[model samples]
Target: MDTSGFLEWLKASLSSSEKTSDRRILRFVHPDDDKRFLRSLRAERPGSKPLRGIRRLGIIRAYSCPVPPEGLPVSFGGAIVWEEDIRVSTHAILAAQRVPADSGIPWGVRRIRAPEAWSRTTGHRVRVGVIDTGVDFDHPDLRHSLERGINLLQRTALPHDDNGHGTHIAGTIAAANRMQGMIGVAPRSAIYPIKAFDYNGTAYVSDIILGIDWCVRNRMDVVNMSFGMSTRSKSLLNAVSNAYRSGVLIVASSGNDGKRGRIDYPAKYPQTVAVGAINRKGEIASFTNRSDSVDIYAPGERVDSCWLRGNRKTMSGTSMATSHVTGAVALLLAHKPGLTPEQVKTVLKRSKRPLRNAKAPRKTGELDIARMLQVADKLM
Candidate 1:
């Protein structure tokens, strides 16, 4: 049967059941079947009302619907209904202390030796997509670094920071108000903030998948994902894989569960460059998820960056650490645009500085931008 037939059958099968109001259904169709799939959704059956709140994510060739809670096959007519899950921001708000404009660069940026690599490339022309809460466009440090971004929650609105997490993350990646405020690792890089999460820093897995789709379609060079969830979602994995295959480097947080060997989804996925956190003393953070899956570490403790309402706040987590790595990746991509995600990860791993304390510290270490750039230079 065609896609519309399958959708019609599925709708009929679910509508006959009693519990159809509480659950959401995400249908994944191949790109070639998108038009037919959407047409089926638009066509009204004789007795049923049109499907409401249908979200179409064309980049991923998927659409989400509200369905009943009943046993349904995983796949139908070449479409897969993904399991529903929630993803949260991986950072912890330490405090809301404001810093002086002359506070200089944040310690995290300086510790990574980003300044040393500035002479060669300061992430000029690199587009970094931040899939998080949104950004504070009015923030002085980030005013000029932001590019037009999409709001998945409200399609017609701009992706403005409401939770402050994206603003901080963006500041770490490319804030450039050097004189009026602090500088980020890649001050010249443009940030495209994709607001998938709400003010509470929570987002559905489908929204995140849509965010990654936006990144790939928009030609973002690097994607900074600071949120994570323990449960694995195949749809999320497929989205990450698709973005990586499209030559977009994905940098994600290793989660802040303090678990020794467990990393979060998307980060746990091998296609992404997973990052962990370190403190000022260069020791592995107590809250960071440490494991072989973690590709590298960076300063994440008590880190300061731009916040909502044009302010600065101190936060901590693998999310902050991930931002540092995201900026570093932007710097590398700025210098060498053709570098693949694997090549970028390899260079980052090779240039890591040894951790002051951790088991098997040599296996993975902190990011060293100066050394990373040097390693990239050797490839030229």
Candidate 2:
């Protein structure tokens, strides 16, 4: 049987006495065939039912199962791949990577030339889904654009923010550019916060996958992932593929591990745009992970944006950088709702401004939101 079928069987028969060492998630080539697959699994293996079903995405129905001492079968009767579930952490390194900000409008805002782009579109018709902890809807800057959110942590439909990280990310992407405080890249865009992480800023692979599934089912135009994990998960690949194939542009943080290692998984995945961090001087931050998968760089060091309690805070991480691209993409999509993930990527990559970064060669360039908008306008 395939890994999905095997896992479905394993989840049903699991007991304290079973000493299985496998930790695998399985996916079917045709996600729409889930019902048929499940029925076949039941017929082939008696007394088995999956613990639960994740069906909203229409690309995967993952099940967790143990690995027998011997090993996973080379192949199931049907097509399937065994995948591992890896924990994904908020990419923020806290104050450790924070750099001193020079006196001026937030460098990130000025660097991308967001004010000029605003004249064209504030992402009015675009819908963005943030897959993070949650957003603080009470924050004045974020209150209007933030719609109802799903708290995957508690499995509730509540607008909540436990770790404050998600709120910060949301503010970067859609905080209404009110005169009083910090503004976002796409101020008028709609934000859907999917709380996948908990108070500790840690989430299981399952949580992130479910969040992506939700985004796909809801028809999100853009999905922002400000987190990273080193290991790759087949389940995640399937989810991302589903979203991309369905016309959602997924953006993720390249990671904060610096020269120590490669870009983190999900970001490293081809379907998502991997963004790195840049300092105020338009140079890559030493902490931003340098890897071939990094598709672009954005202002992330000491970047000022909205925080919890209707406050503004300065944070530094590839996570913050990712929201810049997320909002930028939103603006593009708002101007042209039919922009495919590939077309949006081409415009952003082609319109990037040249930058001098000795340490990170993958830092394609800094975001030029205005130019991107102009190109998108012409294309549309």
Candidate 3:
């Protein structure tokens, strides 16, 4: 629901006078101006509005602030890294902390074969709710993954995918993208979208709780939550616990704060599976939150997956990796039908792709679906 007010402001400034351009950018603006700017933009154009009179200058991938900008910057001044525009600055890192662990590099998602799961059960019939930003249901890879999503911004039950993060998470879970071989853990699984995070990836704790309840009432077999906050509320934990009792497999992302050894809540809650990130080297991502609370690690860095507006983006975070586990559980459940949640966790623990076990760094281990299927065979 928020528009690029910074860009809009810049457009206004540029149009106001090619002469007043000498004025300091972002100066004289309050630190909370971004919020006000967005509110104003919303008051003007509600939805699906094209930024008129603004130049379609490529993009600023990341604008690292030399001083962290206090909070969110009030102005768009400073060196920005545009897709086509090159600037100089050693301190300005990308706004995103995502680092590429893998490129377009092909790797197996590790699926159950016909013996354990049916050949026809591509998870197509099952619906998994992804409570994040809305998904681009039309994305070739995510079209099959999407069913219908909610736009909390518009307060509507329609599909709205402004941010590409949700689409990435959805694809990792079940991107049957035209069957382009870009399969998720459960490519056949359908996705019931939920937009908790806004376009800027900002969401509230209550929104998350409400989203979980919605999933529970909808009888979603699995709920993939790839976002987290530092707070630990009994209400949120109770919601997860209740959802678990409702037979919902809750999977959450360990926050990528990179402070080390701290597990973000929701993921740390017993009701959910805490997932970490692994780079293309098959080594743990240094930025991934590490601790015994972490249940499993999966590919998260530089993951090339579905995006909004018919595009593909390679991003990194435990958020994307958690979807792998969610889809894997769906596949195992569809195949084994009788496996309990504990049994599912056991299979994941025992069949890991084996790391240099130095003190069992995490609660479980690295996820290896291939090994999990083998473990399931023995359990049967």
Top-lDDT structure, candidate number: 1
How far is 321's C-alpha from truth in model 3 (Å)?
1.1
Give per-model TM-scores.
0.91, 0.84, 0.68
Query: Candidate 1's residue-wise lDDT over 107-185, tens digit each?
Result: 9999999998899999999999999999998888899999989999998999987888999999999999877798999
Q: Which stretches of candidate 1 lie over 4 Å from their true place?
A: 9-35, 42-50, 71-81, 85-87, 358-360
- Stretches of candidate 2 off by over 4 Å are 1-23, 28-58, 65-81, 95-105, 358-363, 378-380
Report the C-alpha displacement of residue 113, candidate 2, in angstroms: 0.7
| Model 3 lDDT-worst window of ten | 84-93
**Which of the predicted structures, 1 or 3, would earn the higher lDDT when compared with the native?**
1
Candidate 1 lowest-lDDT run of ten: 20-29
Colliding residue pairs in candidate 1? 20-68, 135-161
- The TM-score ranking, best first, is 1, 2, 3
Clashing pairs in 2: 1-76, 22-67
lDDT of 3 by residue, 56-105 (tens): 11111111111221222344434221111111110000234322323232
